[model samples]
Target: MDINAYSARLHRDLYAAGQLGGEDALVLAEKMANALDPSIRLVLLDAMVEAAGEITEGLAPGAVEVRLAGREVQFAVTPPAVAEPIQPGTAAPAVQPPAATGSEESEADGGTARLSLRLPERLKGRVEEAAGAAGLSVNAWLVRSIAQVLEAPTVQPPPAAPSTPSPTVKIVTGQHITGWVR
Candidate 1:
């Protein structure tokens, strides 16, 4: 995308708005616009990066990344991999997969986002206890657990006929022998 165009448009708008203040404002506006050009472009790039993050989340296990060249913005998308579904009552592997080098590098350089989650009272207590046991904050523990799941193997059941029962997958959420059904 042509980021320069957007930067130019914003400069034009700001300069036009400054016209209300007369000749002195016009001169200052031109100077200010030139000074703010880089900042405006930075803001635009940040917004585009944020949009890419949202898209990536929606496509979990897939990714959409935005990169900035000298005067343009580029987007790279990695499509999700197709995998056979796991049968109901079966669990995904407990072993943690090797590090996702790409994700690790990006995550290390990125900032964190807020997530407001509402869990059942029982579940919340269990999560808190587990986090305590692991010597990490609840948020940290949750983040680690979610990361493990995403990095683990994917499991999706085949589609079922309308007249038949939908296939459900069972997952173990914690230490206990629990059946998290879907």
Candidate 2:
């Protein structure tokens, strides 16, 4: 197995996801060089799977497409879904969602949901920048941020109300020879 090739692909995946950058690629390389903990290694493996989702996010949303190394590929991101409306007098038979393909299922087997978001090139670059500043892998950073958001409630502006003046308490302390209050 080509370790460099593996790293390169991981770099591309993270780069596309607005997570990792050129610099992060080097840090990950260094980590791989030293003895890595099994748990941490598992996390890196998940990050790689998540990176694949990131690459998909960068693709155009029409029919599936592939690009050659020396060619430019054009595409869009519209995922097709069957959402037939229920008839007025009759009910439609319940249908189950199809099982995920082997490759897609493999990611879930590894414990990461592998979600993705399509972002413009400039925006993706900014994500990489932010990830670099935080010294985290692109997938790691994005996943952490997403988990935090999911765990926290959305912020709402405070409601406006009738103006009620707050009560003020007065404090009197006299250690010196001077004490005055108005």
Report clashes for each candidate as comma-separated counts.
1, 7
**Which pairs clash inside model 2?**
19-138, 20-138, 60-75, 60-76, 61-76, 61-77, 61-78
TM-score for candidate 2, residues paired by index: 0.28
For candidate 1, the lDDT comes to: 0.71
Q: Which segments of model 1 are wrong by more than 4 Å?
A: 83-182
Write down the lDDT of every candidate, Cα atoms only.
0.71, 0.49
Clashes of 1: 1
Candidate 2's residue-wise lDDT over 45-157, tens digit each?
55544554555444312122222233222232234244678889998878875322323433556744535589899989999788556544455456556656665988886
Best by TM-score: 1
Task: Tell me the TM-score of model 1.
Answer: 0.47
lDDT against true structure, model 2 = 0.49
Worst 10 residues of 2 by lDDT: 60-69
TM-score of each: 0.47, 0.28
